[model samples]
Target: MREIDVFIDTEEIADFFYQELIKRGFIPAEDEIRELADITFEYLLKKDIIAEEWDE
Candidate 1:
């Protein structure tokens, strides 16, 4: 998984990344976005960078 530390440090960055993913057609729908968020959350959890689920 891609490192999520930068995005975790800034909500704006996370939003920007999400937008880019959509713009690039990497994520096609809200569900995919949620899935990506889940993956990122798991990654963060593994790194112990975040403990709680993100309010998606």
Candidate 2:
């Protein structure tokens, strides 16, 4: 088991990723955080994390 912690200036986006992570049961390592942050939002959008016009 790994304990992952992320600190970013963007709160909303961070929270978004946190929820996505929880839903997917992902606990990314510190090194992977940056890469995850870079792509998680777009990934979630494509995956329909939220039902919005942009995603539809």
Candidate 3:
């Protein structure tokens, strides 16, 4: 965990990855996204502003 707020670069790279994922037909369907939302939340548990119990 880096204590640096590189939001600008983060957003830029996130957009790039998002577009690449969409292009690869790897875009998650709405239902799948909903399902994976829990996984994403678990990941966020290791991050600040979202520190929840990651252990299932």
Candidate 4:
């Protein structure tokens, strides 16, 4: 069997989350959303669910 890899853009995810927050009437700073997105990514990394690219 071949293993498939997936990649996720944290910045794009942050932007989408920010927009959703605004639509739901929650006001959050852009940096705050970015930080949250980073944290989420880190958690996934720690759980071995995602891998970070260091050769970019």
Candidate 5:
């Protein structure tokens, strides 16, 4: 288990986060983008895929 402080209002997070992750063909809708990001973060958390402090 690990802990850290994060700052961001997901609602106001620069919009279309997942879409911007790659300059792909289709742009995902705002809601779909948020959902994709949420699901990805949850999966990473469960898999312990987070980066180590030294990574930064």
Candidate 6:
């Protein structure tokens, strides 16, 4: 199998969502935004779209 390294800036992603929501006039809470981001990451991980890195 081929492997690739991916760097994800989760904070940046959350910030982007927050900004978009604000522009739409739906101001979401910080925790809500974070939870949404977590759910997204979890879905991607489950589908093998992304992998969690282990620290040795």
TM-score of each: 0.49, 0.34, 0.35, 0.80, 0.48, 0.81
Off by over 4 Å in 2: 1-9, 29-56
Give candidate 5's error at residue 6 in angstroms.
8.7
2 or 5, greater by TM-score: 5
Candidate 5: tens digits of C-alpha lDDT, residues 2-56:
6775443445443556546556666567677777667666675578665323335
Candidate number with greatest lDDT: 4
Superposed by TM-score, candidate 4 places the C-alpha of residue 44 at a distance from the truth, in angstroms, of: 1.0
Per-residue lDDT tens digits of candidate 1, residues 1-56? 77564345444445666799878877556666566666776797798877664666
lDDT of each: 0.65, 0.58, 0.52, 0.89, 0.58, 0.87
Model 6 misplaced regions, further than 4 Å: none
What is the model-wide C-alpha lDDT for candidate 6? 0.87
lDDT of 6 by residue, 1-56 (tens): 88889876678778888999999999899999998888877888999899898779
Which is better, 2 or 4, measured by lDDT?
Answer: 4
Runs off by more than 4 Å, candidate 4: none
State the weakest 10-residue window (summed lDDT) of model 6.
Answer: 7-16
Cα deviation at 9, candidate 5, in Å, is 8.7
Ranking by TM-score: 6, 4, 1, 5, 3, 2
- Candidate 2 similarity to native, TM-score: 0.34
Q: State residue 10's C-alpha deviation in candidate 1, in Å.
A: 12
How many clashes show up in model 5? 0
Residue 14, candidate 2: how far off, in angstroms? 0.5
Pairs clashing within candidate 1: none
Which tens-of-lDDT digit does each residue in 3-52 have in candidate 3? 54322233444555566668988975555554455555556655644543
Model 4 over residues 1-56: C-alpha lDDT tens digits?
56678888899889989999999999999899999899988999999888787865
TM-score of 3: 0.35
Angstrom error of the Cα, residue 21, model 4: value is 0.8
Q: Candidate 3 regions off by >4 Å?
A: 1-8, 28-56
